[model samples]
Target: MTPAETRTAGTTPAYAKGRQRREEIVTAAASVYADAGYHGASLRAIAKRVGISHATLIYYFPDREALLAAVLERRDEEDDARGFPREPVGIGGVRHLLALAAHNARHPGIVELYVRLAAEAITPEHPAHDYFTRHYRDARDYMHSAFSAMAEGGHLREGVDPRTAAVSFIALMDGLQVQWLTNPDAVDLVSPLRFFLQQVLTTSLDQALSRQS
Candidate 1:
């Protein structure tokens, strides 16, 4: 049996309750962090917003760092649940990324939290430092492989290297996020990604972006 299946089968009523409460706390923390930024938000404020005692909140998260991790983890869970692919293929991988951009547009709060956490995680002593480091490495590897497949399939434009395209794409997405967060009216998130794909790929960009996943 799969680990997820095993966990589901083994989960008790008390464990389920605890898990739900943890999710609630994480959601509350995400909201607090989004509104005030991570450093500006406090565990006490998060617990108060969740209507839970500070001690009880600590019993679940133990510390602010632990709760922050849970908040990021929960967002990833939500992305997966919302149809973000785990193992991405070439064109489909790009398409999935476009879908993700669309998804991020609707969840500005989560994107803001992610960007803020990412910037803060640059410090070696930060709780999420290792997480961001590993995340970028894994993401780069996956995107490089996907673009390589595109090249192999003859979908990628000439004079473009898969690794270069992958890295550039990641950079563009991150940079665009900050710009869009700064000025949503001036900077678009999804359209720029679609245009990037259009520049790299030989196929129809309109159909690609227009297709609803």
Candidate 2:
């Protein structure tokens, strides 16, 4: 049986401890993977980096793909923790989302990992394909709900499609991160994000208010 299977089957304190250790190993492995691409990184190197036996490392992440998936999961947790504000974000909430993005932008490694995984996740058998699919759907749903609320509350511009706007907004942000990976020096990410939010808010509010006029 696989280590993940074994770990799931047992519920003893030792098993719990093993799970925690595995999480730690995955986190350490993430750091290494972020620095070194998947092909460049090896289990032996990850074990050494985590100061654990090679067998122990393998016990948690049987292969590079598993380790990569763990890293992506960690990233998703972090993003959720930052609070992407529920549907129909107010102006302040939009600012908050931008702030979170700007803060996350500092970790170029995470951005690079995301970019790498985007290409790698195309295969049906890829471990991260499901994770990415779920992530995208969840994120889009959240954005759609928020924008719909805003539109209903007269925060959105007249005739503006909430879903389309949400998609475009997120697309722009994701695209910026991709660009930043190649030329971080060329973009002031925080300021640009803030500007985009302001523009969206202004146009939305004007349209909403104009309709009432």
Candidate 3:
């Protein structure tokens, strides 16, 4: 019998037991997928990990694509939940972003998943296309708003345009993570980010105040 069948064989109440089985399936699939990459992972392996029948896994996920999409969506929501600030970043904002960058850099699996899934999502017909598109847009919008507020508050130098600044800030973090993921020894990700932010703020604030002078 399939792994799915074996799992359901216990004969508990449908609603409660079904929910527990689904969570187990997702947990098993997530670990296998993260270790093996989406294409390398198989339904059989996920079933084996869950100690259920392949049919049981299928009953929950239906197919590999559905399982992969669930993983990506779950990760996106996790990222979003932590990405925005609860309070103003102010003098400490750059450090917070740098810390996040460092954390992502240390976790190569997460980075690899994001890079691979993002490329897949570009095909228009891909299941995650809409989700990835919206994720990027919303992240950019939040960043733009954050920087624009900081600039207007006179925390930034005058000549620095807030929108451009925000874009550059995100771009730098994205680019750095890619590099650091491959060469942690070559990149001082946090220090450099802090330095850059300090310089931008000083130059922009001086220029902003100079306009009044």
Candidate 4:
């Protein structure tokens, strides 16, 4: 039988109830963590927010780290649903990043959660250290491939190295995010990114013109 069918066919009513309750706990925990940061959030407090007892919360998550992982996973699922990485090729990837920044502006809580956890996860002992590590590595690789494709397509300026450009682009995005988080009124994330891309594309055009001249 299919997994869904099996889940409904042989699953006990209590097990189904428990599964639903666990989803509610995860949703509550995500909001708590987003507001308080992982280090400051408490399981008991999350339980209170969900109107469940502390023991019941523990029965589902067992520990803070596990709950944090679940929250991050849920965030990833939401990001995927939002059409993140909709364009994974060449300059389209750069456009996709700008679009993501625009999307982030509407979700301050999720942005705050990411910034707080990413800073904390710099420590090797942090529960999210490995997660952040893999996250950066994957992001860099994707950006690098995108830049490489642009270079191969003759869209990048002369003397521009794809790998270096990718790293710089990622750094620019992260730096802008920090600035925007600190002073949302002063920092316009999408505009700055558009200006950067315009500069890059203009330079590429100039290089092509010089080559033909």
Strongest candidate by TM-score: 1
What's the TM for model 3? 0.71
Identify the runs in model 1 with alpha carbons over 4 angstroms from their true place.
1-15, 82-85, 207-213
Regions more than 4 Å wrong, model 2: 1-8, 11-20, 85-93, 203-213
- Higher-TM-score candidate among 2 and 4? 4
The lDDT per prediction is 0.81, 0.68, 0.67, 0.76
Clash number for each model: 0, 2, 12, 0
Model 1 has an lDDT value of 0.81
Cα error of candidate 4 at position 29, Å: 1.7
What tens digits encode model 1's per-residue C-alpha lDDT throughout 1-213?
A: 544554544332245677788888888999988888778888889999889889989888767887888877777678678655477766677777777788889989888988988998899998888888977886687788779987897778899899999999888989999999999999999888878888998778766445442
Output the number of the lDDT-best candidate: 1
What would the per-residue lDDT of candidate 3 be over residues 1-213, giving only the tens digit for each residue?
645554555433246677788777776777776666566778999999989989888887768888877676677667668655445334344445655767776676776666666666788887778877887776566667656666766777769876777778777776776677568799865666666677677554334324431
Question: On residues 1-213, what C-alpha lDDT tens digit does candidate 2 reach at each position?
Answer: 645665434432246677688777777777776667665668888888778888877767666777776777778778767765344344444555566677767777777777677666778687778887887777676677767766667666676787887777777778888777778889766666655545655364334333431
Give the root-mean-square deviation of each candidate in angstroms: 4.3, 5.5, 7.4, 5.2
TM per candidate comes to: 0.85, 0.77, 0.71, 0.83
